[model samples]
Target chain A: MIELSDVHKSFGSKDVLRGVNLTLPKGESMVIIGGSGTGKSVLLKCVLGLIQPDTGSIAVDGQDVTRLRQGSSERDAFLARFGMLFQGGALFDSLPVWQNVAFRLLRGSLKRPKSEAREVAIEKLRRVGLTPDVADLFPAELSGGMQKRVGLARAIAAEPEIIFFDEPTTGLDPIMSGVINELIREIVVEMGATAMTITHDMSSVRAIADDVAMLHGGVIQWSGPVKDMDASGDPYVTQFISGSADGPIETVR
Target chain B: MSFLATIGRTVLGFLAAIGSVTLFAMETVSHLFRPPYYPREFGHALLQIGYFSLPVVGLTTIFTGGALALQIYAGGARFSAEAVVPQIVAIGMVRELGPVLVGLMIAARVTSSIAAEIATMKVTEQIDALTTLSTNPMKYLTLPRVLAATLVMPVLVGVGDVIGIMGGYLVGVERLGFNASTYLRNTVDFLEFLDIVTSLAKGAVFGFLAALMGCYFGMRSGRGAQGVGRATKGAVVAASVLILAANFILTELFFAA
Candidate 1:
């Protein structure tokens, strides 16, 4: 289980996350939805310890994550349990696709033989609908959708216990977005991994989430199952899901 | 009062920048001695920062050597001391021009490349991805380049010294009407061990500063294309100025007596 309690983060004087509290039970799929610049990404990064919170506690399996010393064996072991797909794919431009996918298996404490690592990478690529030929190409050579698939392939390559997807279908076409959403749903269910995805795409939320959390004003305005989201009477959630411009939640802000 | 306030802010910003750079340098050094070293990354950096830089470093030093020979010959002629060309060129190339020119060339070439590459990675979130994959960015990205540049610079300086002296020797023998054998002999006999040692030492220091500046600016770069551009420009400028400043201080330390 992952728990965030009263998480508050600010950059300069601009507070991005204010007293955010949420929880994801083990092996559950929780999707966080919010408008742009509403600190959805910041909230995710805080849980990953990529951004330190001003005054909050983030506990993964009851252990405080922020206290883990960087570069220590404990920290490495902790990080090894996570798989993250960044918004832009974030593939290593200098390396070929297979190497990028097999990066975790190829180095550090999880070192594997080169041949074995390559085989595993190819298998993971196949799982994400990429061919073996695509393995030799660099990230720059791939299209945006192909790069997203590659990023997904890398995320699952390590078979991590937890997966975080940040705006996974942001730049893809509707068809491709559906394909990726289906892939994510299938993979998460098959792997039984704890998943936290942040996206404003309602299609993605319906396809991939077991529970939906609406983040507004740096806090969870509403939290419930996907079925309950439609009938929930909260004005903010209603306005956001309907994509209404004028409501109690001001879009101008 | 407003002008004084602006001046004070500028001074404080400059000092803060220095402090940040110093801390970054110390962090890089600490990571150097830690385990989980990436030999493959280090080898690639060696090729990128050292071997690939030969043409620029060679070209800069050779032309400067030829120019130094011509100027020394013309200046010596005014005193009827034209025969001093070979010794002066050799000393100048071995002691000063060779290291400084090679250092600046590296600052222009390697430092800018490192900064741009790293800044792009940062912008793309590859550095953060590395963290998620259980890797430390400083260990995986910064240490290898810093170590490779520091180890390979002395060799580059030594090669630059030889090429520069050869340029001077060619100019002396062909353009200045000196006997080839006599020019070579004078050039070889005039250079001392301390000159070569100082040159290599300067090369090492310059290489460290250059790579350090690149990593520092790249890591601290802000978001977007403008940030990457600023980081690249800042890295080259800082590395070049620091190399020149370090050269003067080292010269005083080595030869003040």
Candidate 2:
């Protein structure tokens, strides 16, 4: 289980995340949706311990991750169980596809022998719908969809207990996004990983998430099962679901 | 007022970056002496930061040496002492220009490259990916570069010192009227081991400063191409200023007597 209690974050004086409280039951996929700058990404980052919250307790599997600073042995142990997919796919340009996929398996304290790691990398790449030949190529050589797949492969390579995805479908075509959403759903079920994904893509939410949370005004405005999202009476939810400009959520400019 | 604010902000940012680098560097240096060091990464960093820096450092120093020869020749003729070419060239290049010129050259080459590359990685989220893989980016990326720059700079300075001397000798023998043996003798007689040591120390400090600026700005970049551009620009400016500042202090310490 993962939980955020009364989270608050500020940059300079502007609040990005304000008193955010949420929870996810074990092995559930929760997709957080909001317009740009509504703090969807900030919420994900807070959970991942990438950006520390000013006042919050982010607990993962009963561990207070937000307070655990990096470089501590305890923090290292804490980090051992989490996987994350960044918005841009974040594959190391310098490393080949296989190396990027199996990065966690091959580097630092988790490092295995080179040959074994290579085999594992290739296997993970295959699992991501990539060919064995593609494993030798660098990320710059791959298409955007391929890169996302590689990122997904890397996230699940270690069989992490939890996974976080940030705007996973932001750049892909709707078809490719659907394909990735299906893959994510399958992987979550197969790995039995508790997953939290932040995205504005309604199609992605419809395909992958078990629960949908709407972030607005720096807090979760509404949350429930995917079936409840369209029927939700909240104006914000209606406007967002219909993708209309004339509702509670309006364009900033 | 805006211009002053710009200067103040730049100074503050530079200081903050230096402080952060110092703290991280302390942790990295501690790791350096501890067990479980990454020998392979260290070797690669040495090649990248030091060995690769030579061409730029060498070319910069030699040309500066040649230019110094000409300038000193012109100035000394004011005193009818144009014969001081050998001594002045050796002294200027070795004592001041050699390390400073190399430092500035590296600030232009290595700092910008490191900043732009790392900043791009950061904006692309690759650094975050490194963390998810249980690899500390600081340990893997910044530490090796810092260690390599610190270790290999003395070697670079030694080579630069020799090349710079040769530059002066070539100019003196070919362009000026000085005999080869006299110029060589003056160069040898005028230079002390302290001068060489000072230059080497400057080299290490400047090299560390340059790489430190690079890594610091890169890690701190905001996002996107604009962020990376700012970081690159900041790194070069910071590296150049720090190099000059460190050179002055080291000069005072070495030759204050």
Candidate 3:
């Protein structure tokens, strides 16, 4: 289980996250939806310990992750159990696809033999619908959708206990988006991993989210199951669901 | 009062920058002796920073050497002391010109490349990815380049010194009507061990500052293309200025009696 309590973050007086409180049960798929610049990404980063909150507690499995010292052995061990798919895929351009996928297996405490690591990379690539031949190419050569798949493959390669996907369906065509959403749903269910995904794409939310959390004004405005999202009578949720521009929630801000 | 306020702000910003850079340097050096060293990355950095930089360093030093010889010959002619060309060229190349010129060339070539590459990586979030993968960016990225440049710089300076002296020899024997054997002998005999050692030491220090500046600016770069452009420009400028400044200090320490 992951829990965030009263999380607040500000950048030079511009509050990005304000007193955000949310929770995800173990092995649950929680999707955070919000408008652009509403701190959806910041909420995810706070949980991942990538961004430190101003005054809050982030507990993963009842352990306060935010308080862990940077570069500590405990922090490293905690990070090792997480798989993150960054918004841009964040593939190391200089390395080949296989090496990037097998990066965790190749170095540090999780070191594996080169041959074994390569084999695992190929297997993971196949799991994401990539051919063995694609393993040799660089990230620059792949299309945006393909890069996202590679990023997904790399994320699950370590068989992490938790996975965080940041805007996974962004910048893809509708067909590709559907494909990725289905892939994520299938993978999360099969792996039984605790997953947190941030996306505004309703299709992705319906396909992957067990619970949907609407982030607005730096706080979770509504939280419930995907089925309840449509009928949630809160004006903000209603306005968001209907894609209405004029409502209690000001679109201009 | 407004002008004074602006001046104060500028002075404070400069000091803050120095402080941040100093802390970053300390962090990088601290990680240097720790475990989980990436020898493969270090080797690649060596090939990139040291071997690949030979052409530029060589070209600059050689031309400087040749020009130094010509100037020394012409100047010495005014006093009928033309024979001092070989000794002056040898001493100049071995003691100061060789290392300083090579250092600046590296600042231009290696520092800018390192900064641009790292800044792009930061912009693309690859550095963050590395951190998430249980890797330290300082160790994986900065240490390799810094160590490689530091270790390889003396070798580069040694090579540059020889090439520069050879350039002076070419100019002296061919253009200045000096005997080739006598020029070579004077050049060889005039250079002292202290001069060579000081040159190599300067090379090491200059290389460290150059690569450190690159990593510092690159890691601190802000978001987007503009951030990357600023990082690259800042790195080259900082590296060049630091190299020149360090050269003066090192020269004073070495030669001031």
Task: Give the native contact fraction of candidate 2.
Answer: 0.80
TM-score of each: 0.99, 0.94, 0.98
Judged by DockQ cut-offs, is candidate 2 incorrect, acceptable, medium or high? medium
DockQ of 3: 0.85
The residue-by-residue lDDT of candidate 1 on A147-211, one tens digit each, is 99999999999999999999999999999999999999999999999999999999999999999
Q: Interface RMSD computed for candidate 1 is what?
A: 0.6
Per-residue C-alpha lDDT of model 3 across residues B1-257, encoded as one tens digit per residue: 99999999999999999999999999899997787899989999999999999998889888989999999999998999999999999999989899999999999999999999999999988998998998889999999999899999999999999999989989988998899999989988888999999999999999999999999999988899999999999999999999999999999999997
Docking class of 3: high
- Using lDDT as the measure, name the better of candidate 1 and candidate 2: 1
Give Cα-based local distance difference scores for all models.
0.93, 0.85, 0.93
Deviating ranges (above 4 Å) for candidate 2: B1-36
TM-score of 1: 0.99
Q: Distance from true position, residue A109, model 2, in Å? A: 2.2
lDDT per residue for candidate 3 within A30-80, as digits (tens), equals: 999989999998888787777889998999999999999878899999999
Docking class of 1: high
Clashes per candidate (backbone, < 3 Å):
0, 0, 0
Can you give the lDDT of residue A104 in candidate 1?
Answer: 97
lDDT at position A38, candidate 1:
95
Question: Which model scores highest in DockQ?
Answer: 1
